[model samples]
Target chain A: MKGRAEVRVMLKDTVSDPQGETLQRSLVSKGYDVSRVRAGKFLQLELTGYSREDIVARLEEICSDILSNPVIEDYEYDLEEVLE
Target chain B: MKGRAEVRVMLKDTVSDPQGETLQRSLVSKGYDVSRVRAGKFLQLELTGYSREDIVARLEEICSDILSNPVIEDYEYDLEEVLE
Candidate 1:
């Protein structure tokens, strides 16, 4: 059983993006005119066969509980089935 | 003169992804045991000042002549400079 998906975890707009800020600052220092950079996380996960609803619910639950914060983070996911 | 940027375009992976496979076969026929999904395209542009290496060399020459496609599509950009 193999499950695969791409998950994008991001801080809510209201939350500060320290990594993005640092990256932008670096670019700016290099004379890159960088202004804003919203940093977010992307992840790829593999799992076994499961109901999409169940997986999605679990994913969302994980996001709100640990992967991200309901208070300052949002997430998106893309699930793919590898039929070999 | 204002310039903003937050462009993330994808299509570089052998160039084939039908909207992440119809959104993982509509979440595996609404039961959700999706296996794989890879859809990529995100953009958020806001511009004010320029110079960040001349806007990343004209945004990599407009992502190799038109927002993306070096024969396989690989791009990542984030240039915010809205100091208004």
Candidate 2:
């Protein structure tokens, strides 16, 4: 079976986001009153040769272990079956 | 009044994604048969002193102008009213 996964990985609150800071400054210069902004990574994956359970388990493992830095980031995901 | 916006910026198909390539390599080493993957940026913004229309318009501008490189990336966004 084929499967798809969408993962969102965000920096932990304790981590500083320089990209967000730069963006905030840019928006301020553009006259948009943004109090704050945080940036993160979003991943979309296409998988093959795995059952739903395996897909879930493997994606959970991959999202936590490979996609994000556990010490400074956290991840969330959604999965669905897809056609070949 | 306050508002929130979520923006997703993705590399166009024409552009190569090195991060996704690296992640694919790592997953292959881990034995997950991922045929392909793409990575993007996610942004959450907190805004004040804007009407819903203004929020949308400004975010559309920012997402295109500052958050993403229009030559290689495209962006999408959602906006919602929020309590102070």
Candidate 3:
């Protein structure tokens, strides 16, 4: 069974997100009431030929390996069953 | 009462994610089975003085206004209640 899945990787608040901070500065310059800004990335995959566990394992590896900095970035996800 | 929240934003698969693609290439160079890699961003907010609806409203505004491109990127999130 094939399905759609979403993965989220973000910076630990303690870590300074230069990209996010840069965004904040830009948004402020653009005239918005955004006092705080933290940037992050989200991933959605239409995984096939793999069980949820398998996909999770692959995704966790992805995060730990490169998708996120386990040292500073934290990650989480959700698996949405989608139509084939 | 206030709570903790997480936001996920990513590139629409239709749109090419250069940053993600770059990361994928790097990961492959490091020796990983990452056949298909889609990069994304995640944001965690410890919102206060706001209700779920209020926070969601703000979050949606953030996504539409600056977080995710209402044009291509689709976003979603989960609210985790934590001890204050």
Candidate 4:
């Protein structure tokens, strides 16, 4: 079976985001009403697997172990079966 | 009105993504069935405006002008009404 995953890795609320803060400052100075901005990483993966259970388990491991730094980042993913 | 926007910025298909390529290589070597990976940027913005129309217009400008680069990237966003 083939699957597609959309993953998002974001900093925990306790972690400060310098890039987001800088962008917010710039936007505010430019007279935009943006109050806050948080920047993170997005990943799309295409995988081939034998079963849905296999894919789900592997994806969970990959997301936490390889894709995100668990100390400061939180990651979430949505998976769907794909025809291609 | 208060609104929240989730924006995604991704490289055009024609552009090479070295980071994604490297990650894919690493995953393959780790005995994963991953065939391809594409990495991009995710942003969550909290904005305030007088009405939905006002927020939407400003967010459109902000996304194109400040959040994403048009040269090699494409951006999309989803907006929702927020109580706070």
The DockQ values of the predictions, listed in order, are: 0.10, 0.80, 0.34, 0.88
**Per-residue lDDT of B1-72 in model 3, one digit per residue for the tens?**
465666777677698877767766765677544445566667755554356677666656766787778787
Give the DockQ (C-alpha) for candidate 2.
Answer: 0.80
TM-score of 2: 0.91
Chain A TM-score of prediction number 2: 0.89
Task: Tell me the tens digit of each residue's lDDT in model 2 across B43-72.
Answer: 989887647887787788788878899999
lDDT of each: 0.61, 0.85, 0.66, 0.94
- Native-structure RMSD, model 4: 1.0
Poorest lDDT segment (10 consecutive residues) of candidate 3 chain B: B31-40
Backbone clashes under 3 angstroms, per model: 22, 0, 7, 0
Model 3, C-alpha of B72: deviation from truth (Å): 2.7
Residue lDDT tens for model 1, A1-84: 454766767778888877767756755665544456666654444445456666666666544664456788788877766566
Write candidate 1's Cα lDDT for B1-84 as tens digits.
356775666676677778667755655665545455556644343434346666667666554665456777777876655455
DockQ pick, better of 2 and 4: 4
By descending lDDT, how would the candidates be arranged?
4, 2, 3, 1
DockQ of 1: 0.10
Better of 2 and 4 by TM-score: 4
